[model samples]
Target: MNGDKAPVRVWCDGCYDMVHFGHANSLRQAKAMGDYLVVGVHNDEEITKHKGPPVFTEEERYKMVRGIKWVDEVIEGAPYVTTLETLDKYDCQFCVHGDDITTTADGVDTYHIVKSAGRYKECQRTQGVSTTDLVGRMLLLTRGHQQRGDSEYKVERSRTESMSEDSAAKSPWTGVSQFLPTTQKIIQFSEGKEPKPGDKIVYVAGAFDLFHVGHLDFLEKARAQGDYLIVGLHTDPVVNQYKGANYPIMNLHERVLSVLACRYVSEVVIGAPYSVSKDMMDHFKVDLVVHGATPVATDVDGEDGDPYEEPKRRNKFMLLDSGNTMTTELLVQRIISNRLSFVERNQKKEAKEANLWKAMNADQEK
Candidate 1:
């Protein structure tokens, strides 16, 4: 810790099950207060014990948090019980948490340990948004079968059943034989046509709220990786459900247009409630799922004593490690903090120009 260098250590922790703007904001603020921000992700057992079941698995949660811009490293363990030993391990100059959790149930002040250690501060919570609000809003908005009546659901089920029956009836072969391809030549041709170079296929999907250069670079790399690049814009409802309420600064349509305008993206696909599913991958046959090298992979201990085994299951996914880049959340914070100064500077310039014009007019009249 050289006096001339930046503060090298900071500690922050959260459930981080769904990466949202609020989470990003907190991380950015924490990082700004220090040089390196070490994030502790709540393990599945810990989250389940304190809160209800998390929408994402522990591994997924870890990956989402790691993907954030300010997160220097992710500790995959229970964060609920923070100890002096843990704080000392990182040689952290301070421990940061949202101000929203400053009070206890009886209104007694909390976070005494960090304070005693001469390192504690609360970052401002992004107002009017949270994970709970997002989930509740989604469940309330969607029209369920119970409210619409069972007949509608039943009717849809019957239609699907009838369609299957009709398709089976049209087949020339009887029984299971109808399911098999009539000619082996067609199957061979399809198999031979596998992923080839120059195929104009596109791939794009994420909670891309605050668009930044990293996103742009990733899209550019994705486009270069394929003949075409189709971005999957997550819908507002889906985004709210997956991410917390304090997410997606831009709405679904805005997000769509943002990606559409990008030179790399040729088309856009709306991502549903969660991660890209097998159905979507199969339908698009995306040769690559381009991602940045921000360590967006969850480490889980396996029988072989390797933590990296879990993320490897996504074989079709290609991890493209882009250089360290700024994120939209960080950009927003910088703007907000400097907004007043920026406004005042602009106003002063405008006044100066007006005064110069008035003096010039007076001189001309003289």
Candidate 2:
């Protein structure tokens, strides 16, 4: 009978906004524990009512989770309150969540009901990386270089460790498999995975913030044009100069993983320049440069500026059809449309994460 049993179905659910290595690692661990790993993404309304304004919408979160190498099926609109009925509906034997405490406004644990029902399981959270830490980095970037006081326990070391953690298949998340560079990813982007004989190298650059279908489609099209696709991601400062208002909801490393996760993307330039220069082209041996149909941004002089200026002058520039593509602008507007609620949600989250971080520090001091 034991040999005849069907594969066990494991279910893990979360908001998964600002999907990162930590989330990926958790999913990987959950996946390793069972045969089939299905992730449930709570709806935006449920998340907003509970966790606060998510950097990414439920829809965006759904896509991001699906893209993770460890994830199998993704259930949209999973109930915020996980019930035995919810588990039964999905044919899941049990639910998995991180060890971190995620409670409600009234200090009610969301998983309490499920845990009491004996349908809950906990997974060890990976140390050194979290969405809260990343968000803090973004907020503090504007503070200019400042050092933490001797009395204040520093989060700097953890931040560096988190930053340096690879998001590819080699990440701590997946059990046996990690993202290994193909020749193209090494050559073009590093790039990795060396190109085959006579293979052309395609170059494209952008903020690629809040990476969406538009970015995916654009990258896919670019990949089709050449054997190797190298995507240059601009710095956050460069992105801000062009795309004001806390642009690039996700950071450089986050954006890098988002792009590198895409099958169409062969490699990535972590901090690529805003403008395409001759040296960059020669360095990467770029045969072509592609841009989406989105409008270009201007420089400090307020003059119309295209980053791909040199590519055009070299007659290697081309425009890809993004097909009514979604932009970071539209994505931002969606969150902004619910601005008051979103802002309040973020503030609450900041306060909560801050308190938790402080408590952790205090415990360590003790």
Q: All predictions: root-mean-square deviation over Cα?
A: 23.6, 9.0
Which residue runs of candidate 1 sit more than 4 Å off their true CA positions?
A: 1-3, 102-110, 142-366
Whole-model lDDT, candidate 2? Answer: 0.68
* lDDT digits (tens) for residues 33-149 of candidate 1: 878889988787876555445545687577666656567888888456565777888787678988654222232334567767777888876543344433322322222211224
**Candidate 2 regions off by >4 Å?**
1-10, 18-25, 28-36, 52-57, 83-95, 104-107, 112-201, 210-217, 220-228, 244-251, 277-287, 297-316, 329-337, 347-366
lDDT of each: 0.54, 0.68
Task: List, residue by residue over 1-366, the lDDT tens digit for candidate 2.
Answer: 136787777889888886765676678778767778889898878877777667776776887788665677999998776778878887888888888767666656678888998888888775544554444435333211122333322344333233322312122221111123234422322225766778799998899876665676677778899999898998777777877766666656556766775656677888898778899999988999988887677573355676677899999999888574577677556654765564345445545645665566799999
User: Residue 219 in candidate 1 has what lDDT?
Assistant: 72
